[model samples]
Target chain A: MSWELTAADLPDLARGATLLGTGGGGDPYIGSKLVERVLGDGAITVLDPDELPDDAFVIPTAQMGAPTVMIEKIPAGTEPVLALRTLEEHLGRTADATMPIECGGINSMIPFVVAAETGLPVVDADGMGRAFPELSMETFAVYGVHGSPLALAGERGERVIIDTGDDDRQMERLARAVTIRLGGVGHIAEYAMSGADVKRTAVPRTISMALALGRAIRVAREQKRSPFEAIADTLAPTLYSHVRELFVGKVVDVDRRTTEGFARGLARIAPLDGGDELEIAFQNENLTARRGGELLAIVPDLICVVDHETAEPITTEGLRYGQRVRVLGISTPDLMRTPEALAAFGPAAFGLDETFRPVESR
Target chain B: MSWELTAADLPDLARGATLLGTGGGGDPYIGSKLVERVLGDGAITVLDPDELPDDAFVIPTAQMGAPTVMIEKIPAGTEPVLALRTLEEHLGRTADATMPIECGGINSMIPFVVAAETGLPVVDADGMGRAFPELSMETFAVYGVHGSPLALAGERGERVIIDTGDDDRQMERLARAVTIRLGGVGHIAEYAMSGADVKRTAVPRTISMALALGRAIRVAREQKRSPFEAIADTLAPTLYSHVRELFVGKVVDVDRRTTEGFARGLARIAPLDGGDELEIAFQNENLTARRGGELLAIVPDLICVVDHETAEPITTEGLRYGQRVRVLGISTPDLMRTPEALAAFGPAAFGLDETFRPVESR
Candidate 1:
C-alpha cells in the first residue's frame, strides 16, 4: 500500500510519533515545525517496502544526540539533506528513497524533510518500530545490516563520514562522540540498504501505523471519548496489540540530567488516590518500567507517558514533577522481541538488572 | 637533494626526532620498533618537496593521541598503511609520497614507516617544525591547507574519514574525540596536499635536519666530545640557529596525568646546588618553560630536556623525579616563527599567559 503525506498530515504523524518514541526522540512540536517549514505545499509519496524494486536503494536518516539539547538548539532544517547528500557522495550512488531509521518525534519527521528537499519519496517502514537510543539497537543491525558507511552533518555544515566496516558498536560510539562536539545534535544518514534488506529487516508500515494512531487519538478527542480506549482500539489490529494503561498518577520526581549526548534519567509517578508508585528509567528512550519494584514493561517493550486528559505524549526531556499523566505499556512487535533483538536492546543492554519481560507476559 | 633512509639510519633519526619532539610526539623506541617491523630490508627514499612535480599529491601521516598510551598499546605496524590506503580510497588517487605532519618522537618516523610500505618516497619536510598539542597548530593549517578529507585507522581496523571543509579547528576537535574512543591512540593520515602546497606551507628540509642532528650527537658521544656543544654546532648553520642551554638541574617534581587523549602535566627542576627552580608545562608537547617567574622559553620555540650525561632527549612521558637533566632552548625555523605560524602554535594558543619570545631575542 502507498500513501501521500502532505503538510496537513504532519501534526497527526507527530502526535503518533511521540507516542511511539517511548519518551525520547526529540520534541514532537519541533519535528512538526521543521517539516512544515520545508514541506510547503508539496506532498511526500510514502511507499511500502514491497512497492519498491528489490534493487532500490533506501537510506535511513535521523537526528542523533541529547533531545534535551535539541529543543533548545533546533536543527537548521538542512542537516538531513546535507547528511543524505554526503552519504550519497560517499557511496557514489543516489538514494532511490529515504526512510526513518527509527520511530520517534524528530526521527520520524526528519526523513520527510529530506524527502521534500531531494524530491525522493519516503518508505513507509522503519528499522525500529519504536525508538531505541543507540544506532545498533535497530532490528536492521540485529538482522546483520551494516551501519556504515554512515554520514553525519552538523548545523554548521560540518560533515563526517564513518566507515567502521561492520562494527555497529563502533559506529554508535564514534557518532555519539561527534554529535557531542557538533553541539549535542547532528543529522545522520546510515544503514544504506537495498529494498530486499528493508523488506527483511524493517518494521513494515510503521509510518501508516503512526498516522493511524494519531488519527485515532484526534477522533477520540473530537467525539468526547476516552483517548486511552481509542489507543487500545487503534493498536488492536496492529503489530503492537497488547496495550495496557499501567498507571494513572501524577509525576512526583524527575531525575534527569542531559550528559554524554544523551538525556539519561528516571521518572517516578505516584497514584493520585494512593497506590504503589510507577517508575521508568530511560536513556534517550524508555528502557524499563516498574510499579512497586515489580516490572511492568522492560525494553524491548514500549513504556510511554502521556498527558492524563489530552493523551499527548510526553517525551523524556519534557517530563516534569507534579504533572498528571498516564503511563502505558505497549507490547513491541514479535520481530522486535526475538532473541537477537533482545540481545541487541534488552534491559541488560541498558545496564538494567532484570531480564526482559514482555508487557503482555507480565 | 634526496637521501636514502635505511633501517640502520633509524636510530640516529629517532634520536634527532626526540630532541626536536619537544617532550612529545610519542616515544622514539616504539616508533623505531614499528618502522623496523615493517621496513625489513627495504630502504625508504627521502625526497625534498622541490624534487616532486608541482601537481604531485603528498599525504602527511602521524600517530595521534597520548604518547603515554601509545607506549602501552603499540600500533600493529599496519595502522599507518591502513590510514594511508583509506585516505587514498577517499581521494580516489594514489599518493606520490608521504611526509610527517610534525616533528616528534614517533610522528617524524611514522611517515617513514608509511613510505617503506607504500613504496612512496618520504618528503624531507613537515607542517610543524616542532610538536604542538593540537592538529590545527601547524604551519600548513596556519597558511591555509585543508586538513580533510582526513583518515584515521585504529589497531583493530576501525577507519574514520572526516571532511570538515576548511574548518580545521572542528577537525581537531572531532578527531581528538574519536581518538579518545579509539582506545586513547590511533594512526592518522591528514592534510592531503599538493607538492605546491607543501612547498608553500611546510618547513623544508626538517627530516634532513633531524638526521644531521641525530648523527652529530652520536658522533660527539663516540669521540668523547660534549654532545651539547655538538648540538649547538649542528644547529648553528641550520634554520634553528639560536641554541641556548636554558638550565642544568635535577628534577624535583613531576605532576603528570593522562586524560582526554593527551598527556598533560608540569615538571619542576632545581639547580643541583640551589637557585630558582625551572618549571615546564606540557600538554603532549612542552608549551612553556619558566625560571623563577621569568619566561626562559615559550611555545613556537623549541624547549627540549636531555639527559645530563648522555645528552639523549627525554620525552614528557618519560620525565621522573630526581633525574639530572639539561634543558635546551633552540630557535624554530623562520617559517615557524612567522606571525601567522606564531598565531597558530603560539603560547596563547595553549592557554598560556606569556607571549611568544624568540630564543635569539631572549
Candidate 2:
C-alpha cells in the first residue's frame, strides 16, 4: 500500500489514536484539529522504518505538559518545527525524517505538523504503539538512547536546548517542568537516533496500526455494529471480565484537589442499570476504576470511562454530577505485561489484593 | 562520629534542607516538625552505605506532590509510614533500612518518621545529593534500576500501586496522576533495588553531605557570616559565587502558568540596594536567574533564590512582589558537567545564547 496521509486519514488517525491510548492519552479531538488545520488533502508520506537508510537522521517530536492547559492555552503551533530546527542547528545537521512518539492519541498526529511545516515526511512507525508517559520512558531509553541537547520551542516565544546526563529522565523532568512553565505546552525533538536505533527501538508500523484501528471502528459504526467490539477485535486484546462496573448511569459525585499545578479529582457514578456505585479518579488521565467494594482496573493499562453515547474521552476535572458514563476495560500488551510492569501496575499496586489474570485466562 | 542523630542536629537538618532544595522543594518546617514530633530525642542511626550489609533490605521513601501544597495540606504524619507499610505488604517482604530519595528538603525528613515507627535505621546517603522535579528523575533511574513493585500508600484513607513499562516517566506520569486523584499527597517506596544495586546506583554519603552542610551553615551563622559563604566553604566544590542584589526592593511583576501539574511563574525584583532591577523565573524550583538582560544561572548546576535574611525556599508559585531574596549559585558534581548535562541545562536550554560560565567566574 502506498503510504500517504491525506485529509481523509485524520478521522481514522484520531479514532485509532484513542484506541491505542488505552484510555489515558487525553482526548484526541484537540490534537486532531491541530493536525487537520495544518495539513489537509495532501497525504502525509509514511516511511517504513526498514526503508530508511542506515545513516538516516531521524528525530521524534512531542508536546510536553498539561492537556487541559492545551485547550485553554493555544499553541504557537510553530514550536514543533522550531524544535526540530533547533536540533538541526545544535548538531549542524538536518534531519532526514521524522516520527511520532506514540501512534495512539494526540501524539499520533504531532508528526503531521512537523511534516507539513518542515517538509519532512512522517515515519509510519513510532516509539510506542501506545502512549507511555515521560520523555525517557520509551524503548529508546532501554536501547541506551539519550535525550540531551533537546531542542524545545514553544509558540509563546520560548525556546531552548537541554542536554542532560545519559539519563533521559533528567531531560524529561526539566523539559516537563519547562513546558509547564511555558504555559502548559512545548514541543521538542528527542531520541535523536540513527536509522538503525529508530528501527530497533521504536514500534514498527504504528501509524498503519493506528489507521487500521480507526478504519475498523469507522467500519463498525457504519455497519451499525459494536465499535467497542470492533476495537477489541482489531487490537487482538480481550476485555477483562471482573470489570463489572459499579454504575451504569450518571455521575453523582466529584471531589477535586488542585495543587502542583495539576487538577485531580474523583467522580462517583450511580448505576442506571442498578448497583451500589462506581468511582473513577483522575489527575490528567483516568487512573483507578472501582465499583462497590471490588477493584476494577489499574494503571499501565487503559481503564476508559467514556461517555456512554459518544465514547469520547472526558477529562476527570471536567466531569460533574449527573453526567452519564460507561466504564470500559481493556487488556494491555505484553510489552507492559513484563514482571516489572505488573509490579508497577498490578492489582497490588493499585490497592487491590486480587490477582490480575488476563481476560482471556479468566 | 557515633552515627546518632542528636537534638541539635534537627535545626541544622531543616535549615540545610531549605538550602539544598535550590528554591524548588517546599518549606521543610512541616516535615521537620512531623519527624521531630514523632522521634523526639530518638537516635536515628545513620549507616554509611559502605557499612550496610550486602543482605540489608533498604527502601527509600518520599512524599510526591507540589511543594506549594505541602505548606497548605500538611501531611497527616501517618502518610509516609502508611505508604511504606502498604509497600511492604505488597512486596510480601520487610524492609531492614529506610533511606531518603533526596536529602535537600522535606523528603530529607520523611525517612526519620519511617525509621521511628518501623524501627528501620536510615541510610546515610541519597540518590541525588539535591532535589529533582520528578520521582523518575532520581539517580536510581540513571543506573538502569527499574522502579517497580513501587507501592504508594495514601493517608490510610486511600492506597494504590502503579506499575509502568520500564519507563520511569510512565511510572511518574501514572503515579503523579494517581497522587493528584487521591488528593495531592501519597507516600511512595520506589526503585526497590536489591542490596548490590543500591550501592552502585545511589549517590553515596548524601546524608553526611547534607548534615555536614547543615552543620556548616549553623556554625557560620552563629559566628556572624554569610550563609552562602558557609555553603561554599562546606561544598569545597569547584565553584561558588553569590551575586550582589541588583535590586533588594519589593517584587514588581509576576507571570504564572500551571501545566503538567506544576505552578510555574516568573517575577521581577527591584533593587533596594539602589542597583538595577532583576528578573527571575521558576516552576516549583527556580531554573534561571538574570540581572539587566544578563543570565546569571541555569541548570544542571543549581540556582537557588532564598529570602535574603531567612533561608526559606521561595517557590515560583510563591514568588510575589516585594519579596526580598538573594540569589545563590552552586555547581553539581560530574552529573551536570558532561556535554549532555550542559546542553540540557545551559543557557541555550533556558533560551539564552551565551554559554553558562561558573558564577564564581562571573
Candidate 3:
C-alpha cells in the first residue's frame, strides 16, 4: 500500500516511533520540528518496497551519535540533504527513493524530512524493524549489505566519504569515532542498495505499522481505556509477536554516562505497590530487562518504557528518577531472530551471560 | 641541487630528522625501517621545488596522532601508499611528486617511502622547517593552502576522503579524531598544491639540511668533538639561525599523558653542577623552555633535547627521568616568522602569556 504522509500524520508518526525507539535514537522533538519545517506544503510520498522498480537505487539515511548532545546542538538544518547529495554525487546517480536505516525515534522522522526536501519518495520499509544500538546490528547487514562507501556530514558543511575493506563492526567503530569528532552527532547516508535487495532484506511496512500503533494509543486515550492493552492489541497481529506488560513501577534510580559516543547505563524501577523491583540495562537502546536475576526480556526483543498515565514513551536519555512508568515487552520479528541476527544483537552480543530466549518463549 | 637518497643516507636522515623534530613527529625507528624495506634496490630521486613543473600536483603526506601510540602500534606498511592512491583516485590525477608535511622525525622519512614505492620523486622541501604540533602550523597553511580534499588511510585498509568548508584547525580536529579511531595513528595525504605553491610556501632544502646536520653529528662522534657545536655550525648558514645551548642537566621529573590525540606534558631538568633547574613544557613537541619563570625559548623557536654525552636527539615520548641531556635553542625560519605564521605557531598561539620573541633576540 502507498500513501501521502501529510503534516497531520507527524504527531502519530513521532509518537509511534518513540514507542519503537525502546529508549534510544535520540529525542524525536528536534526531528519532528525539522520535518515540520521542511514539510511545509510538501507532502512525503510513501512507497511500499514492492512498488519500487527493481533497478532503482534505494539509499538509507539516519543521524548517529549521543542523544544528549543532539538535544543541545541542533543541526544547522542542512546535514541530511548534504549527506544525501554527497552520496548521490559519489555514486554518480540520484537516489530513486530514500528510506530510514531504522524505524525508531528520531531516525524514523529523518528520512521523511529528506524526502520532503529532496522531492524523493520514502520507502515504507526500514533496515531495522525496531532500533538496535550499533550500525552493524541492522538486518540489512546480516543479509550482506556493506556499510561503506558511506557518506557522513557535519552541521558545518564538513563532509567525509569512507570506503573500507572492513566488516560492519569495524565500520561502526570508525563511524562512531567520526561522529564523536563531529561534536557527538553526525548525519550519515549508507547501505545504498537496489530495490530488489530492499524487498528481500528490509522490514517492510514499518512506517505504516508505526502509524497504526500511534493511532491506537491516541484512540485508547480518547476512550479512557488502558494504553498498555491498546499497544498489546495493536501489536498482536503484526510482525512483532508476544506483547505483554513487563512491569508497572516508579523509577527509583538511573545511572547513565556518555562514553565512546553512547549513553550507557542501568535503570532500576521499583514496583508501584512495593513488590520486586525491575532493572533495565541499556547501551543507547534497552538491551535487557530483568527482575531479581530472572530475565524478562533480552536483546533481539523490544523492552519499551512508557509513561504510566499518558503512555508517552521516554527515551533512554529522557528517563529520570521518580517517573512512574510501565515497561512493555514485545518479541522482535522473525528476521531478527535468525542465528546471524542473534549473534549480532543478542544478549551475549552485549556481554550478557544468558543465551537469548525469544520473548514469546517467556 | 638534485640527488638520490640511498640506504647509506637513512641513518643520517633519521638522526637529522630527529634533531629537527624538536621532541615530536613520533619515533623515527619505524620510519627508518619502512624506508629501508621499501628503498631496497630503488633509489628515491629528490627534486628541488623550483625544478618541478608549475602545474604538477604536489601532495604532502604525514602521520597524525599521539607519539606514544606510534611506539607500540606500528603501521602495517601500507598506509602511506594507500593514502596516496586514495587521494589520487579522488582527485582524478596521479600526484607528480611526494613531500613531507614537516621535516621532523618520521614525517621526514614518510615521503621517501612513498617515493620509493610509487616511483614518484621526493621533493627536497617541507611545509615546516621543523616540527609544530598541529596541522595549521604548516607554512603551506600559513601561506593559504587549504588542507582539504584530504585523504586518510589506516592500517586496516580503512580510507576516508574529506572535503570541508572548514579552516585548517577544524580539519585537524576532524583528522585527529579519525587517526585516534584508526588505532591512534593514520597516514594522511593533504594540502595538495601546485609546484609553484610549493616553491612559494615550502621550506626549501630541508631534507639536505637534515642530512648535513646528521652527518655533522656522526663526524663529531667519530672525532670526539662536541656534537652540539657541530650542529650549531651546520644550522648557522641555513634558514634556521642563532643556535645555542640552552641548558645542560639531568632530568629530575617527567609528567605526560595522552589526551585529545596528543601526548602533552612537561619535563623538569636540574643542573648536575647545581645552578638553576629548567622546565620544558610540551604538547607532542616541546612548546616552551624556561628557567625560574625566565623564558628562554618558546615556539615557533625550535627547542630540542639531546643526550649530553652522545648528542643524539630524543623525542618527547622517549624522554625519561634521570637521563642527562642538553637543550638547544634555534631560531625559526623567516617563512615561519611572518605575522600570519607566528599567529598560527608562536608562543601566544599555544596559550603562553608572553608575546613571541625569536630565538635570535634571546
Candidate 4:
C-alpha cells in the first residue's frame, strides 16, 4: 500500500485517527498543524512495511515525553532533524531511511515532517504499532532492539548524545533528563536498526492500518455510515463502538502538582449519551473511564475522548468538568499484553483493584 | 577516614552540604532530615578510592530528578536501594558495594542510607568530585562509562529500566519520561559498571573527600576554625563573595505552568553586598548569576548561593527579594571534559559570552 498524503487527506486522517486513538493518544490537533506546515499541499508518501527492502535502515523516532508538557511548550520542529543528523554522524554511516516513530494522533505524522526535511521515506510500520508512553514499551523492546545511543537534539543547537550501553532502563532515564532540560520537549531518533532488525521488531504497516481506519471513517461519513462501524471495518476487528464525541465543557480543576501531568482529576463528562454522568481520572493520558457509576472502560486499554461529532482526539488537560464529551474504548493488542507491558499499563499498574484483563475480554 | 555520625551531626552536614550545593541543588533541609532519619549514631566509614580491590563491584547510586519536587513528595527512602537491587537483579549479580553518585546535597547521603539498609560497604569514591546538574556530567562519563541498564524505582513500586547500549543520549530521554510519570521526582541507579569500570571512571576518594570536607566544616565550626577556612582547606583553590541571593524579597510570583518540577524562574535580588541590585534566572540549578550591571559567574561553572555567614546552601525556589545570602563559584575539573559532558554543562553550553577558560587560569 502506498500513501500520497495531500492536504486533503489530513482531515480524514485526523477524523479517523481520533477513533483509532481509543481515548488516550492525545489530541492530533497540534500535530496536524505541524504536518500541514511541513507537507503543505505536497503528497506524503507512505510505504508498506513488507514493500521495503529487508535491510533498510529502519528507525523509530518521535517526541517521547509528557504529552501534557508538549501541549504547552511546543517543539521547535527542528529537533527531529538535528537528532537524525547527529545519529547519522555518530553512526559514521548514512542510510536508506524511513519515517515517523509511531502511528496515532500526533506521532503519526512525525515521519512526514522528518521525511520532508531529511529526504527519508517514512516507514509505514511502527513499533507497538500504536502510541505508547515509554520507549522501552515498544515492540522493539519486546525483541532485542535497544533505543540507545539516541541522538536527543533540540532545535536550539543543544544536542544531547545519550548512550546507555545495552541497558533498557537507562535509555529512558537519560532521555527523560534531557526532555526536562529542553523545556519539556525534545525530538528523538532511536531504535537505530537494520532492515532485518526492523522486520523482526516493528509492527509492519501500522500507518496503513491507521490510514485504513481513517479511510473507514471517511467512507462512513461519506456514505452515512456510523463512525464506530467505519472504524471497526477499517481495523477488521470484531469489536468497536457507536459513540459520538461532543466536547464542550468547563475544566473544574487541573491538579498538575500531584498528577505531574498525568490526568488525575475528574473531568465531568455530561454526555450527549443522555447519561446521568461520566468522569475520568487521568495521569499523562486518560486512565479510568466511568459513566453514571458504570465502569465504561477500566485500565490496560485505551479510553479515548473525542469531539463527539468531529472525532478530535481529546487530551486529559483539554477535557473539563461540566463539559460534554463522547467516550470510546480501543483494545490493547498482544504487544502491550505481556507481563512487563501489563505491569506498566494494567489496571493494577495504575493501582486499580482489578488485574489486567483484555479490554475485549473484560 | 572514619565518621561516627551522632544525632548532632545533622545540622552541620545540612549547613555545610548546602554551602557545597551552590544555588541549584534543591533544599538541603529536606535532604538533611532524610539523611538523619537513616543515619543516627552509626560509625560511618569513609574509604579512599584506592582502598577498594580492583575487581570488586562498585556502584554509585542516587536520586535523579528535579530537586525541588523531592521536597513536596519525599522518597520512601527505598528508591536508592530499589535502584541498586534492580541493577543487581538485571546483572543477576549482587553488588559488593555502593558509592555516592554525586556529593551534592541530598545525593551526598543517599549512599549512607543504601549502606545501612543493604549492609553493603559504601565506597568513598564518587562519580562527580563535585556537583553538576546533568546525570551524565560525572567522572564516569569522563572515563567513557555509560549510565544505563540503570533502574529507577519509585516509592509506589513503579519501576522502569533504561539501558541504552552505550548511546548516552537515549538514556536521558527514557529516564525523564519515567520522572514525569512519577510526579517529577524519581531515584535512579545509572552507569552500571564493574569495579574496573568504576576504578577508571569514578572520581577517586570522593567519599573521603566528602567526609574530610564534612568533618573539616564540623571541626572548624567547633574549634573556632572559620567554616569558610575549613572548606577552603579541603577543596584547595577557593573563590568566595558575599553576593546576595536572588529572590531576597517575598516570593511574589511562582511560574509553575512551565515548571515540570525543575528549579526555574527569574528572581530579583536586592543586593545586601553593597553591590548594585542583581537578578538571577534558574533552571534546576542556577545557571546565570548576573549583577544588575555585570555578568558574574555564567554557566558551565557552578554558581551557588550560600547563607552570608553560615555557609548554608540556598535553593532557587525559596529565593525572595529581601534575603541575605552569599554566592560562590566552583569550577568544573578539566579531566571530566568531554563533548557531551561539556555540551551538557560547559560555559558555552549554558549560553554565556565566555569561552572555556579554566577558573584557575582565569
Q: What digit string (tens of lDDT, one per residue) describes model 4 on residues B1-362?
A: 43444436556655555555555555556766676687666645555556667778777778767776766777888777887886676567787777877766677777777776776776766776556566766667656787866677776665556555565555665566567666777777777667777767776664444445567767776787666666666777322212222323223233422264456666555544355655556666666656666666555555666555655557766565456666666665555455655665666654555555433333
TM-score of 2: 0.50
Taking the tens digit of each residue's C-alpha lDDT, what string does model 1 give over B1-362? 98888889889989999999999988877788778888888888999778978999999999898888888898888899999999998889999999999876789889988887878999999988877778888889989997978899988888888888888889999999999988888889999999999999999899899888999999999999999999999999988899998999999998999987889999999999798999999998888889977999988889999999889999987888889999999988888877787777887788777778897787
Model 2 chain B is weakest, by summed lDDT over 10 consecutive residues, at B238-247
Model 3, span B99-151: residue lDDT tens: 99989988998888888889999899998898877887788988988888889
**Residues A133-202, model 4: lDDT tens digits:** 5555566766778777677766565555555556655676657665665666677888888877776767
Evaluation by TM-score, superior candidate among 2 and 3: 3
Ranking by DockQ: 1, 3, 4, 2
Off by over 4 Å in 3: none
Chain B superposition TM-score per model: 0.98, 0.86, 0.98, 0.84
DockQ of each: 0.82, 0.02, 0.78, 0.06
Q: For candidate 2, give the lDDT of residue A44.
A: 70
Per-model lDDT: 0.89, 0.68, 0.88, 0.62
Off by over 4 Å in 1: none
Per-residue lDDT over B56-154 for candidate 2, one digit per residue giving the tens place of the 0 to 100 score: 888889988777666777887887887787667656788888898877778888888888777788887776667766776666766667676466765
What TM-score would each prediction reach against the true structure?
0.99, 0.50, 0.97, 0.55
Query: Positional deviation of B173 in candidate 1, in angstroms?
Result: 0.4
Better of 1 and 3 by DockQ: 1
Model 2 interface Cα RMSD in Å: 16.0
Model 1, residue B192: distance off in Å is 1.1
